[model samples]
Structures are given as C-alpha cells and as structure tokens.
Target chain A: MNKKYYRWLILILALLVLTFGAGIISLLSGEMDIPWHTLPDILVQKEGIQYSIVTQIRWPRIVLAFSVGGALSLTGAILQGIYRNPLVEPYTLGISGGAALGIALVVVLGLHLSMGSYMLPLAGFIGSIVTIFLVYTLSFRRGGININRMLLIGVMISFVASSMMMFLMAITSSENLHGIVFWMMGSLDEPNALLIDIMLYASLAGLFISYLFARPLNALRLGEEKARHLGIHSTITLRILFVVASLLTGICVAVTGIIGFVGLIIPHIVRLVIGSDYRILLISSFLGGSFFLIVSDIIARTVIAPNELPIGVITGLAGGLIFIVVLTRANVQSKIS
Target chain B: MAVYLNIQQLVCGYNLGFQLKGIDLKIEKGAFAGIIGPNGSGKSTLFKAISGDLNIQSGLIEMNNKKLSSFSLREKALKMAVVSQFNEVLDVTVEDYVLMGRMPYRRNFQFFETKEDLIIARKYMRLTNVYQYKDHLMTELSGGEQQLAAIARALTQEPELLLLDEPTAHLDISHQVQILNLIQHLNEEMGLTVLIIIHDLNMAGEYCNHLVMMNDGNIHQHGNPHEVLTYQNIETVYNTVVIVRENPVSGKPVVFPVSEKTFKKTTNTSS
Candidate 1:
C-alpha cells in the first residue's frame, strides 16, 4: 500500500481502538459498581444482580455519547462538504438555533404533553427543515446559492434564537429555569434506551444518505460551477445535502439540546489526519466524531467525579482549541504553498 | 455548418445601479470568433451573457435555434463550457479538480466516481498537455501551467462551444503564445466553435476566424483580419495611428507601433 494509504489506515485503527477503550471505561463507571466479570453476561441478556447498573444507567448513557458524537461529527463532515468551506460546521447553517428554539419552547412553556422527549425532537426536526428551507429559499436565485449570504442569515437567526432562550429563562421559575438552561447547555444526564435507539436509527439514515454522495462532495470541493460542467446538478446536490444534514442536526439537537462543537471541530481534524478525499473523510469523520465525543463524555463524567461538567462545555472548549490549531496549520500550509 | 449560437440584439452586462444595455450580433457555428475591445469595453460582459452566467437585461440569446432562456441550465452547460478568469482554489489535486467536469452527469444518489469519469478527465488532461500535472496540487503549478490546467478542466467538459475570458492574462509571453497556440489547434483540428476574449490584438488578428472589434458595446468593424485591422479603423477606435503590414510568414495583417512622427513619413514608409 502507498504511504499515505498506510498512514490513514493506522490513524483510523488507532482512533477506533481509542474510542472502543473509552466506551468500555464509560460502561464500567459510576457509584453502582457493576462487577466487571458479569459485564459480558449483562450485555448478552443473561441476568445478573448488577444488570440494572450496567444496563439501566451506564449502557444507555454510553450509547447516547456514541450516537450524539457520531451524529454531530457526521453532520459536520457533510455540512463542510455541502458548503465547500472547511471552517463552516453544522451549526454554521443556523439550523441548530431552530432546534434550540423548539426544545426551549416546549420546556419553558411547561407543555403537559404525554411524550415530551419525542415531541421536543420532532419539533427540533421540523424547525431544522423550516430553517434550512428558509435559508435556501432566501439565498437561492437563478439556479445558484450564495454561501456567504446563507451563512450570514444562519448566524443572525442563531443570535435571535439565543436571545429568545434567555428571555424564557429570565421569566420562568428558578427550578424549571435551571433544567431548561442546562438542557440548552447540552447534557446526557437523562438517558433512555428508546431515545438512543431512535437517534441512532436517524443518524444511520442521515449517514447512509450522505454516503450516497461521497464522490459528489469530492467534486463539490471544486465549487458548484465546475461541478455543473461535470454534469452534476448543483442545486439538487446542495438542496439534498442541506436538508438531510439539517435533519441529522435537528434530531441531535432535539435529543440533547445543542451539544456544541462535535459537528464543528471533528471533520477538520479528520481531514487533516487523512487526505481530503470525500469517501475517506466521511467515514473517518463518523469514527473520529464518535471517538472524540466518547472521550469528551468520559472526561465530563470523571473530571469532577461527584459533579459532572456538561458534555457540551467539555466539547466546546476542546473543539475550540482544536479549531485554533487547525487554523494555524492551514495558515502555515497556505504560506508554504 | 449548424447554427450553433445566434445572439440577436443581445444586451449583456451587470445591473449596476442603473441599467445594462444590449447590442446586436450573430455568430455562426465552427467559427474561431474573437471578441476584442479596450479595457471596460464590455467584451467579457458579452461573453457572460451568451454563456448564461448573466441573465439578459433586454435582448435575446439563442443557441442552436432555441432561445437561451428556454434551455435548462444543465442543457446550456452541456453545450457550452467556459474557462473563466483565474479561480482561487487551495490544496486541490489537478486530477480531482479536472474530474469536477463530470459533476453535471451524475444521478442524484451517486456516491462514487466511475472508471469512465476518470478516463474522460485523463483524456482532456492529455489533450491539453497537462496530464503530467494531474497529481500536482493546484497551488503548486506555475501560472502558465495553471492556465493550461484550467483549459484542460474546460476540455473535460467536452462542450461543443468553448468560451474563454482572458485565459492567458497571467501567463508570461512564451506561455501566452503556447496557450493561444493550443486554442488555435483546438479550433482548427477539432472544428470546435471557439469564442475567446483576448486583449492582445496581434494574437486576435492572427488566430480568429471572424474578428469582432467591439467598441462601446458594438462591433466597430468585424470581418476578415485584413478588412477590420486598418490604420483608419485603428485610429477611429483607439485614437492612435499605427503601421499596418502583412506578416511575411503567415501573410496576416500585423499592426506595428508608430513611435516617431509618421504622418509626414507615411508615404515614405509604406514601401
């Protein structure tokens, strides 16, 4: 194999291993003290006394970490492809704001819905669809989408959404306000297997659709004009990717309430490690994102020990640092060239 | 020959605060047409209008007997490939960049490039003589090499009509000559209808099948190189006097600068 190919293979394997190790550590953690020996027994569904500790709390949370991390990173990767800008992430489109608003409205208003979790996520998904549709419609004309304009609209909407959340928080009771604010900050404190399963399934669908256009993303890196000459329908490709990725971001936001940076930082890191080929970038992004989130969640769980830091906080700080490093590296690369 | 492109009273320009005007012109198929005018003469603007990059303000643009507005964007793209002014791209490999020419050909859910796509990219790269640079980074290539690569990228489109807007702008003299020569070869050898907006009048005079000397958004004089490139026409269009002579080698009209006073010495220098 070529040297580049070998390096990419080694990096992917290492990341995969690292992520697996982190998941195991997460599965074994907390005060419940599930015996490590019976962990495998619990996994296979042959009962054990510690099954509740292993399955009820630890497993669900761990699964949540993986799905959220994977979904965010994959969304980030696909968004970068669609926008054709490495600096732009999933939230860069402003769909996350729509998701945030959906969650906040349900929580702050104290809607006595029977299935709040499902309703919140569904609201988020619909919000994303509407936001992306608005952005597309506003920016598109004469068969072209102006990316800078679209991104500007997204940023403005996010700011507006953030203020709306703050307003709701200011007016609500302190008890409910705390939960809403924390949810907006992003967390995995409340995990149910059904939510994980639903998100995992949704993520799988988004990723499969994204995978269907790996080569087109590669082509898109050259910009839409050239892509059109190559016989790609630029508008159709952009629309499909935006809608699908928004859906993924929506589900994630609805489930976790604005977990920042997973979709922002992971794809660029993966691209720098591997080459910019869309096939490899997309796959590695999913794995790398899953691994990063898993590790971040681990840090979130263990660092304070008795008190956990929000997963969003950990990811945001870490992702911000990584983004700076990437910026510098890109600067140096351009300088050298 | 087929009526490949016909622009009747075609007004092409941007809507900059006020209005953009249209001008009349008709272009036949298989012609090595050149649009030449001084800077700000709307030469590139006209090209943009015909290529569907800019919508017409008023006049009509037709291709193959159909109105330009009538053709779908993809259909227009399939028929015309434009090698626009230099593009700013970073870290893209030449092969991958060239393969972008195949994007319009993909089904919605296609996640991979087929072997046939690679073959087509290679063929165009080879034709433009930039095949060796296929794996080189776009930022790494020299100006002339990049320009050739850009042409190769357009060639990958395999369009019936090739439109280039100041394609040789950044190249050095030898490379500029090389690029122009390549375009000339593509025109004559393949019988492709070539429309280029070149600044160098000498190059335009040398290669064009039909020269459109546009001044103030209108063709001042357009016909054979011999008929259009006269001392009077040059004087009227550019407000400068020049010596017009036959290029001894190609027998084409060649314009030389009159640095010293030539009005009194015109008769003496004619021989």
Candidate 2:
C-alpha cells in the first residue's frame, strides 16, 4: 500500500487497541474491586457478585457511554458536514433545551412517579423530535432550508424552552425541583439495559446511514451551491442529515442529559488526525469518541472515589481546553494560508 | 443548429435588494462568449439564472430547446458546468476535489467512485496540468494553482456549456494568460460552448469570439468583440474614457483606460 493507506491502517489499529485497553481498564477499575485475574472467568461464566457488578452495573454504564459518545460525535460530524461549519454540534440546534423541557414537564407534572423510569426519556425524545421538526419547518423557505434562519430560530426556540423549563421548575415542590436540577446538570448515573440497547442500535443505524451518504457529505463540505452543481441534491441531503442528527441527539439527550462536548470536540479531534474524508472521518470519530468518553468517565469515577462527578463536567473542562488550542491553531493556520 | 442556451427577458434577484431585470442573451453551439461589464452590472446574476441557482421571477431559460427549469438539477449539471470564484479554503485533496465533478454521473446513494470516475478525474487533472499535485491538499497549492485545479474540476464534469465567473481575477499575468489560453484551447479543440464573465476586457477579447456587455441588468451590446468593445459603446455603458485598439499580434481588440495624464499626453502626441 501507499503511504497514506499505510498510515491510515496504522492509525485505525492503534485506535482499536487503545479503545480495547480503555474498555478493559473501565471494566476492572470500578467501585467493586473485581480481581483482575478472575476478570476473564467472570466475563465468561457470568456468575457471583463480582460478575454481577461487572455485568449488571459496570457493563451497562460502559456500553451506554460508548453508545452515547459515538452517537454525539457522529451527530456532530453530520451537522458540521451539512452546515459546512466546524463549530456546529448536536445541541447547537436546540435539542438539549427541548429535551430538558420534556423532562421538566414530566417531573413537574409527577408523570414519572406514576408512569415509571421510561417516561422521562420517552417524553424527552418526543419533545426533541417535535422541536427539531418545528425548527426545520420554520426554516423552510422557497423549498430550501435557510441555514442562518434555522440557526436563529433554533436559538430562539431554545430560549423559549429554557424559560418554560424555569417556569416549571419554579412551580414545582422542592423535592421535585432538586431532582429536576440534578438531571439538567447532566448525568450517566442510571444504566438502563433496554434504553442503552436502543441508543446503541440507533447510533449504529445513524452511523450506517451517514456512511451511505458519505460521498454527498463530502461534496457538501465544498458548500451547498457547489454540491448542488455536482447533483448531490443539497437540500434533500441537508434535510436527511438534519433528521438523523436530531434523532441521534434526541436519543442521547433523552438517556443522558446533555453531555455537552462529546459531539462538539470529538469530531474536530478526529478530523485533525484523520483528515476530512467523510468515509474515514465518520468511523474514526465514532471510535475516537467512544475511547474519549470511556477515559473521561474513568477519570470522573476515580477522581473522588465512591462519589463520582458528572461526566459532563470532565468533558466540558477538557473540551474547553481543547477548543482553545484548536482555535489558536486554526488562527495560525489561517494566517499561514 | 439549435441554440445551445437561450435566455429571454430574464428577471431574478434576492428579495428586492438587487436584481437582474429583463436580460436577454443566447449562445450557439461550439461558440465562446464572454459577459463583461462594470461592477454590479448583473453579469454574475445572469450566470446564476442560467445555472438555475437563482429562481427566475419572470423569464425563460432554455437549453437544447427545452426550458432550463424543466430539467432536473443533475440534468442541468450534466449539460453545463460552472467555475465560480471559490473564496473558501477547502481542506480537500486535489484529486478528491476533482472527483466531485463526476458526481452528476454517479447514482444516488452510491458511495464509492468507480474506475471510470477516477480515469475522468485524472484526465481533467492532467489536462489542466495539475496532475502532479493530485495527492496534494488544496490548501498546499497557491491561489493560481488552486484556480487551475478548480478549472480541472469543472472540466471533469464533461460539460457541453462551460460557464466561468472571473476565473483569472486573482492570477498573475502569466497565470492569467495560461488559464485563458487553456480555456480557449478547450473551447476550440473540444467544441465546448463557453460563456465566461470577465472584468478584463482585453483578456475577454483575446479568448472569447463574442462579447455580451451588460449594463444595469440588461444587455447593452452583444456581437463580435470588435463591435462591442468600441470606444463609444464602452464610454456610454461604463461612463469612462478608454482607447480601443487592435493587438498587433492577434488582430483582436485591446482596451486601455484613458487616465487624465495619459489622455492629455496622447492628445498632445496625436495633434
């Protein structure tokens, strides 16, 4: 193989190894001290307290982290591609505010108490889809989605949603208020097997669909007019990607409240390493994001042992640092170009 | 033979701010035409209308005797390719960028480009003389080289009607000539119909057989360069004094602006 292919191969292999190593570390280093020597037997035989801790508790968290991180990054990649703007991310279009409002309604109305654990996520998912659909419909002008208008509308809707959520919070009992605030701050505390499985499958489906549109997404990065000239149906492509991004973002936010920067920064990091070909960019981003969140979650767990920090805090701090570095480097590169 | 492109009473604009009003023009098969005018003369707007990028308010654009709007965007793309000013610095490889031109031919949902697509991309890259930089990132090339790569990408579309908007605006003298000459050679040898918008009248005169001088969203004059590039025609439309003379080498019209000092000196010499 030529140099480029060889380098890509090496990079993929290295990422796979790192992801595997990180998964093992995550599985072993949780609160319950499962002996490292018996870890293989625990995984295979699936018995005893250690196995239960590893399988029922740690495994779901780890898998959920991977799925959520992968979904967010893939969402970011697609949004950036469709917008032709690198700064865009999953929540940039107001999905977070919408999902938060959904949960707020559920909590304030005491619906979750009656309907059980699935109610919050279901409501959040519905709210997100509705909000996205509304924003999309509002932005449609002359048979095309005006991106600038769409962004503005999304921001406006976000403000409205947040204010409504605050209203709901104000009228709620102190007990429900505390619960609402914690969920809004974002968490991965509860690991539901069914929800994680759904999100995992949804993220994989989103990734597959994104891969199928890779060529057109590549064309889209050149700009809409050019992509249209190339016969890529720029409008249809943008709409499809918008739906996919919204679904992925909705599902992620529904399960784990707004983990901010996995979507924003992971794609940028992947692009920096792998270059801008969407075919490779999407796959690498999924892997890179999975690895990043696994490591970040590990840090979140072990930093103040027995009492874990929210994963968002870690990702936000690291994402902020990375953003500054990326901004500066982009400035320097722009000047050079 | 049928007219390859026909635009009649075309009026288009972006929400009442700026408009191309009642512009009419036509291009015959295997002919090179240049659209020239002062800034804001609706030249680019006319190109947009023809390319179906702008929605026509009230007008008719026909390609191959069919309404331009009748064809799908892909059909339009397969018929005509445009090379406009690409100001953004795209982070794509030269070869991959060129491969975008073959997008019209590929089926929807087809991700991988075929061998034939690669061959066509390489063919155009070689034609535009940017084949050596096929693997190089677009950012790594100079502005002139990038412009050539853009042209190569346009050529890869295999268009019958090639439209260019100020393609040589940012190139050096040598690069400008090199680009114009390449475009000229393509029109002549490949029998491609060319409609180029150029601010430089001299280059337009040299490369384009016909000229369409636009003024205030309308065609001011349209004919051979010798007829449209006259001093009276340019002075009236552009509101500037210029000396129009023939190039001794090619016997084509060359326009030179008559600045105050140069006009005085030239008058003194002539008297």
Candidate 3:
C-alpha cells in the first residue's frame, strides 16, 4: 500500500516536472527565440519589446493553454467515469458542436460587429448551456437520469447542432464563412485578460471540486447500482458531476472554439500510465493535458516560423498520433505480460 | 429472539407491473435465513426492496424496530451490506476494491481512506482468504475468487446484516460449498445476520436454519428447513415433482427431483 502511494507521488512529481519543462519551452521557442536565462529578468524589469512580447502575448497564451487543456482533460476524465466508457468525452455530449453553432450564428448575423468582440464567446457559452440543459432534461426519467439515454440524446443533439452550423456556414458571405471556419479550427490567441483569468480560476476550481468527488468516482467504476449499494447517492453524484464537467467543457469551448483531442487523449494517456484511481487520475490528467497543450502550442508557434498553424491542428495531429502509439504499445505489452 | 428485519404488506415492482404483491415476513437477529423460489417468483424483487434498491409502493420495511425508509442510503449501508449476484469486472486491484466498503464511513472532505479503514479492509480480506490476491487485479481472479473479494468488501463494511443474492449461482460445487461454509462460519462465530437467496433448494435447506419459500410474489411457506422444504410446498411452488428426504450426515432436509421414468413407473403402479 505504501509502495502504491509512493508510486503515485513519483508519477505526479514527474508530470509536474514535465509540465514545467513544456511551459519553459513554450516561453522560449515562440516567434523570436527568447533566451532561457533572460526570462526571470524580463519578468522583474517588465520593460522592453521582449518584455511586451513575453508578458502581453506569450504569457496569457500559455496560461490559456494550461487552463483550457487542463479543463478539457479534467472534463473528459469525469465524463468517462460517469459514463463508464473510455470513449466518452466532452465532444461526445455535443458541447463543442453547440459552441461552434453559436459562434457560427454570431458571425453570420454580424453580432460581433454590433455588440462587441465578447459577443462571440457569450453566444458560445449560451449555446453550450442550452445544449447541456436539453441533454439533461431530455434524458431525465421519473426515477433519475438514465446514462445510456443521455448518451444517445447527446449524440443526436450533436448531429442537429452540427447540421445547423453547416446550414449557417453555407448561406453566409465569404468573409463570415472565413471567420466561422477559423474559430471552429480553434486558437489560443485571446487578448482578453478577464477571459484568461476566468478560464484559469474555473479550471482550478473544477479540479478542486472534482477531487472532492474522487472517492465516489472510484466507487462508480464498480457501476452505478453497486456504487449506490456502497452508499454513494449515484444519481446525485452523477448529476453534480455532469453539471461540473459540462460547464467546464462549455467554458473551454467558448473561449478556445474547439480544441478537439486534448479532452479525449490526455485522460486516456494518463490512465494508462497512472492507473484509474480517480484520486490520482484527476490531477494527473490535468497536468498531463496542460503539458501536452503547452508543447503543442510551441509547435504551432514555431513550426512555420512566421506563419502560425491553428493550435487545434497541432493538438489533433500530435494528440491522435500519441494516443494511437500508446494504445498499440499498451496492447502489445499486455499481450506479452 | 428480537426481529432484525420485518416486512408487512409489502407491495413493490417496476412500472410494467407489480412483481412483489402483499408480502409479510420476519427474520430474527443473527439468524441465517434463505429465500428460495423459481424464476420470476419475486425473490430478487423482495431482496431489492429490502436493500433499498426498489421503492415499495405501499408497505413497511423495518430493521431493528426502525423504519427502513427513514434511514439514509449511508445509514442503510452502515447497517447492512449486500453482495450482488453480478458485479462489473473492473480494472481495480482487489485491495482497492475491498477498501471501497469503507466508503459509507468516510467523512465529508475525506480524500483518502483512514488507517483504521485500511486495517478493517485488510482484516476482511484475510478473513475471505483474498489476502494473497490483494495486489492482483479483479479481472485476473477466478469466479470464486471474485465472489470472495466481493464478500470481503461487504465484510469490510462491518455491517450487522449481510445479504447475498444467489452468490453461488455460477460457481462449481466445490466453490459453492466453500462460499456457503464461510458464510455459515461468519454467521456462527461473529453472530452476523445472513439473508441469502439461493437457487439450490438442498443447499438452502442444509445451510439455512430459517427458510422462506415464495411463489408468485407471495410467501408460499416460511418455517424451519424441514417444514419449508416439504415435497408438497416444493411441487406446488416450483411446478415440479421433488422428493424430500433427510440427509444422513447433517439430518437436514434434502430434495431430489423425480425423473420422468421413475415418476411414470410410480404413477402407473399406483394407478
């Protein structure tokens, strides 16, 4: 038992170190190569073109990457636990599609021009909230929320939302279409300090609240009925977890458009390495996701030098490849052992 | 003896139809009782009602003079633990799975299992003979071992009453005997109240001091094994011909199904 605890400690520490390394790389490698040693001085002095670039541009993006990535992965872990299926992620519930449809509608109607730039994320949030409410209410039965029913409803809603989004995209002008497509592809280049702060705090709070239910989540792995037998109010626990995860995913999608694979891939990788004990899985997936996105953001920034790729593109490519490799390797190792 | 569980006029079922009709039963404290019936006889429904899985439409279920409905899920868990017939095959290790029994005792904001919880879990693991498999994954264990692990987890709950639903259903004879013997030992040595649902009438008759026979959601008979396992009640409830005889070793009532040939020959001779 002590050894198992020690292993968790070491794995968490290793993930922390790796995340820190990724953050440093993200800071140093973007656009103009900022020297590693000058980082501390630039932070304290707070005055130069380098300082402006580091503080005004790169720092917020890094924090955004961390929170958005962590929040998505954390949401994925919670959703997977509730559904008891490894494939269930934030997107499976259609939150991303809802957000995308919201953004597309805002762009098509020229709401961002009339209302303000913030209208985009506001519409996105509103869209996701509506989707969540629909899914939650539609699937609720006389006794409680049937999980399988909810999954099916979520998938159906996602299809409808995506179809609506495509309809809007087809009718809109080329300029509006371009805006909608870019937002759908996703990026971390937000200039709003307030949004960044909200994302960071919300992600951390999501982690903290999710940690409180870690034991229940662990009990849930034995299946919902068994969890209730073990004294967990499965219905209440699942409802609260669903809200928490959906809100987190909603916030993430609103801010970043739709960063796809972090939510699906990070938790999968973390579970493989650290085991599925939610006590460790939650925190580990959060850190692993932050690390993955920070590294992916660096590649997005530097791979083309002057021309930057959408952060989502890098994440999808890197995350998908990594997941395939890890799964195949795990399959092989399990067969051998 | 004081009654541990009392059910009066219990009527409960799913939305399609009522599975358990008006049923009345009482089990004294520390008694090893078994409920036996054929499929769709409401044995499982009754068990679910008592375990708080199914809400009774109209009736009362009391445990130790307190209304079972009044107790919270956590409170019910504290008083009784159930080893369900089918548990999901999970990726968790045996030790971690067994430690989940301590969940009801976990205080709010408690992140990890307490030292005392670990000790209790270990004690039960040892008792159930799953100590050696503690580090092994639950999926790696045999059916009997998994059932033992489940029982160990239930034991770790330190519940006053232990309920099992056909625990030996899928096990081979040796494993069946092993599980029943352990249950009997727990009942005798620790004074635990056991209420089990068993398909095998002979095993129920041999192991249980008290037996309740059910037919169509109502109690067909309830008495000592000798009285409850009579040929008349067995044939009427199960719709089969069975001969009841006293076992030579334990002297408990044993049931043997009459073969078609023997039944025909006996009928012909009698006619």
Candidate 4:
C-alpha cells in the first residue's frame, strides 16, 4: 500500500484499540466495583445482580455515550463542511436549542410519556425539523440558500428558543424543576433503554449516509460556485445535509439533553491530526468522538466517585483545554509554514 | 473551426432592473478569448450567466450547438470547468484540492479514489508545479502557489472549455506570466477553448487572440485584440487617457494609463 493508505490504516487501527481500551475501562469503573476479571463472566452469564448491573444499566449507559458522541461528531463534521466554516457545529444553527425547547415544553406539560418513550424523541425531532425548515426558508434568496444569513437567523432563533424555555421553566412546579434543569445541562447517566435503542439505529444510518456524501462535502470546501462547477448540486446537497444533521442532532439531544462541545471539538481535533478531507475526517471523527466521550463519561463518574457529575461539565472542561491547545499549535504552525 | 460557444441577446444581471442588454458574442473552437472592462461593466456577471450559476432574464447560451440550459449541472460540469476568483485559505492539502477536480467523473458513493484518479491528479499537480507542495496545507502556500494549485485543480477536469475570473489577480509579476503561459500552453497544445476575465490590459492584449470589452452592461467592442486595445477605444470606454504602443517583442498592443500628475505637468509645460 502507498504511504497515504498506510497512514489511514494505522490511524484507524490505533483508534479501535484505544476505543476498546476505553470501553473496558468504562465498564469497570462505575459505582459498583465489578472487578476486571469478572467482566468476561458477567458479560456471558445473564443471571444475578452483577450481570444485571453490567448488562442492563452500565452497558446501555456506555453505548449511549458512544452513540451520542458518534452522532454529534458526524453531524458536526457535516455542518462544518456544508457551511464551509470551521466554527460551525450541529447546534451552531440552533438544532439543540429547538430540541431543548421541545423537551422543556414536554416537561412543563407533563407529556413526556403518557403514550410511550418515543413521544419525547418525536417531539424533539419535530422541533428540530421545524427549526431547520424555518432557517432554510428564511435564508433562501431568489434562487439559493445564503449560509451567512442562515447562520445569523439561526442565532436569533436560538435566542428566542432559550427565552421560551426559560418562560416554561418559570411556570413549572419546583419539584419537577430540578430534573428539567439538570437534563437541560446534559447527561449520559440516564439508563433509559428505549433512548439508547433510538440513538443506535439513527446514528448508524446517519453515519452511513454521511459517508456516501463525503465526496460532495470535500468539493464544497472550494466554495459553492466552484463545487457546482465540479458537478456537485450544491443546493440539494446542502438541503439533505441540513435535514440529516438536524435529525441526528435532534435525536441525540432529545435522549441526552444539550451536550455541548463534543460536536465542535471532536471534529476539529480529528481535522488537526488527519487534515480536512471529509472522507477520512468523517470516519475518524466517529472513532475519535466515541473514544473522547467514553473517556469523558469515565471522568464524570470517577472524578466525583459516588455522586457523579454531569458528562457535559467534564466534556466542557476537556474540550475547552484541547481547543485552546489546538488553536495555539495552529498559530505556531501557520507562522512557521 | 466551428463555433463552440454562442451567446445571443444575453440579458442577465444580479438585480432585475439592472441587466446586460442585447449582448451577442461567439467563440470558435480552441480559441483563446479575454473579457476586459472597467469595474461594474458586467464582465463577471456574463461569466455567471454562461456557467449557469445565474439565471438569464431572456436569451440563450449554446455550447457545441446545444442550449447551455439543456445540460444538467453534472453534464455542464463534465463539459466545462471554471476557476472562480476564490481567496479563502482552507486547511486542505494541495493534493486533495486537486483531487476534488475529478469530482465530476467520480461516483459519489465510491469512497476510495481509483488508481486512474490518483494518476490524473498527480499529472496535473506536476504540470502546475505544485507537486512538491502536495502534502502542504493549502494556506501554507503563497498566494501565487495557491493560485497555481487552483488552476491545476481546474485542469484536472480536462475540460473542452474553461472559464476563469481574474485568475492572476493576486500573483506577482513572474507567477502571473507563468500562469498565463501555462494557460496559453494548454490552449495551444490541448485545443482547449478558454475565456478569461482580466484586469491588466497588456496581459489581455498579449495572451488573447480575441477580446470582448464591455461598458455600461453592453459590449462596446469585440474583435481581435489589436482592434479593441486602441487608444481611442480605451479612452472612450474607460473615461481615461492612455498611450497605446506596440510591444517590440511579440508586436502586441501595450497600454499605459497617463497619470493625472503627468498630464498636468505636460499641459503646464506646453502652455
């Protein structure tokens, strides 16, 4: 194989090994001290409380972290490509704000699960879809979408959604306010099997679809007009990416609340290491995101031990540090180059 | 040679009320053409219309006797390529940027670049002298090197027709000549028709066989470079006095704008 192919293979293999290592570490370090030796037996035998904790509660939580991380990073990479801006991420266009509003309203009305667990995700998905459509329509000029206009309008809408969510919070009973507030801050600690199931299929399908469009995404880096001259249908590609990214982001947010920075920081970190060809960036982002979030979740659990901190806070600190480092390194590299 | 691109009564502009009116032009196959005009003369606007990035109010553009609108975006791209006036410094490598030019020919779902694709990319990179910087980030290159990489990417399309908008606007003198020379070489050796918009009159006069000069959204002059690059034509269209001379080397028309200070000093001395 050529040097390029060799680099890709080595990077991927390294990520897989790190992800497995992180996964095992996550499985071992929870509140219940399940020894590393018991892991294989616990995984195989489904009976007893040890098996119950390992299989039912802990495994689902770990998978949720991985799936949610993977989904957010994939959408983040797609958003950055479509907008042709490094600062853009899944929520940069207000997908998370819409989902948060949807969940807040659901909580205020006590309509989270009168019917089933799917209702919450459905609500969040609808809110996200509506927000995307609104931003798209408003940004549509005579013939095409204006990305800057969409970005500004998205920020405006996010402000509106946040106020509405605050209003909903003001009217809610004090008893329910704590749960609502904590959820809004983001957490992967919820052991909801149904939410995990929802994220599994949607995130997988989103990754597959994103992989297929990687070629167009790469073309778009040259700017929209040039991408058009290179056979990419820019408007159609943008529209599809908008919908898919919003959906992935919406579902992930609905399940785990508004997890910040994983979407933004993972893709940038991956790009810094591997460069910005979306084909490699997309796959490596998923792997990197999974690893990063699993590690973050581990820190969230162990740093405070028995009490458990929100995964969002841990990611916020870690992501911020890494982002600062990347920016500084980029500054130095540009000066030298 | 047969007429390859024909634009007739091409009325188009960004705003509805402001438009290029009754513009008609034709370029023969394998011809090197240049469009030169003052700012806001609708030179770039005309390019947008021909490339199908802008909707024409009323008129038609034909390529190879087929209506330009008849081709799908992909079909249009397969037949023609454009190097737009892009200025952003992205983080992509030079090799990847060049490889993107093969997008029109690739199946989108196929993730891996074919062996043929790599060969084509490397060939164009070497041609543009950007192969040495293949692994460097795009922003790492100088403005001139980046411009060459952009041209190399456009050439990877292997198009029959190429449209460029002020491609050499940012390059230094030597790199400007190098890029224009490479473009001329492509046109002459490969039989590729080229339409370029240029701000430098001398370069336009030197490189183009035919020139189209615009003023107030109208084609003021369109003919051989020697006819269009005259002193009277430049003064009339540009509202500025210029001395037009012949270059002794290639015998092409050369233009020099008379600065206001020089004009005042000469008038004062004569009086």
- Number of the top DockQ candidate: 4
The digit string of per-residue lDDT tens for model 3 on A1-337 reads 5678899999899989998888887877877998899999988998999999887888899999999999999999999999988789889998988988989998998989999878999999999999999998888767677798899999999999999999998999999999999998889999999999999999999999999899899999988888888899999999999999999999998998899899898988888776789999999999988998999999999999888999989999989998788778845345212
Better of 2 and 4 by DockQ: 4
Task: List, in the given order, the native-contact fraction of each candidate.
Answer: 0.26, 0.59, 0.72, 0.80
Q: Model 2: runs farther than 4 Å from truth?
A: A1-10, A170-173, A322-337, B15-21, B260-271
Query: What residue pairs clash in candidate 4, if any at all?
Result: none
**lDDT tens readout by residue for model 2, B123-218:** 989989999999888888899999999998889999999999899997899999999989989999999999999989999898899899999888
The superposed Cα distance between candidate 3 and the true structure at residue A52, in angstroms, equals: 1.5
Return whichever of 1 and 2 wins on DockQ: 2
Worst 10 residues of 2 chain A by lDDT: A328-337
Q: Write the per-residue lDDT of candidate 1 for residues B1-271, one digit (tens) a residue.
A: 6777777777656656322355767777888888887776678678877776666877787887888888776676678888877764646678877876766666667645678878999998998788998877788888788788888878777778899998888778899888888888988888788999988778888888788887877778788788888888887888776879988999888888776456658766786
lDDT of each residue in A1-337, candidate 1, tens digit only? 3444576678778878988888887787765545667678787884665677667777778777888888889988887777766677788777877776766677766662566556766776766777777777777766667877777887787787778767877888897777667767888865556778988888878778888777667767767766654445666888888878877887788778778888878887777666577777877888788888888887887788778898988998988997787768754466222
Candidate 2: true interface contacts recovered: 0.59
| lDDT (C-alpha) at residue A139 in model 1 | 72
The C-alpha TM-scores of every prediction are 0.85, 0.93, 0.97, 0.95
**Lowest lDDT 10-residue stretch of candidate 4 chain A:** A328-337
By DockQ: ranked, best first: 4, 3, 2, 1
Worst 10 residues of 3 chain B by lDDT: B84-93
Write down the DockQ of candidate 4: 0.70
Output the better candidate (2/3) by DockQ. 3
Model 4: CA > 4 A from native: A112-122, A330-337, B264-271
Off by over 4 Å in 3: A330-337, B269-271
- Lowest summed lDDT across 10 adjacent residues in model 4 chain B is found at B84-93
Instruction: State the lDDT at A7 in candidate 4.
Output: 83
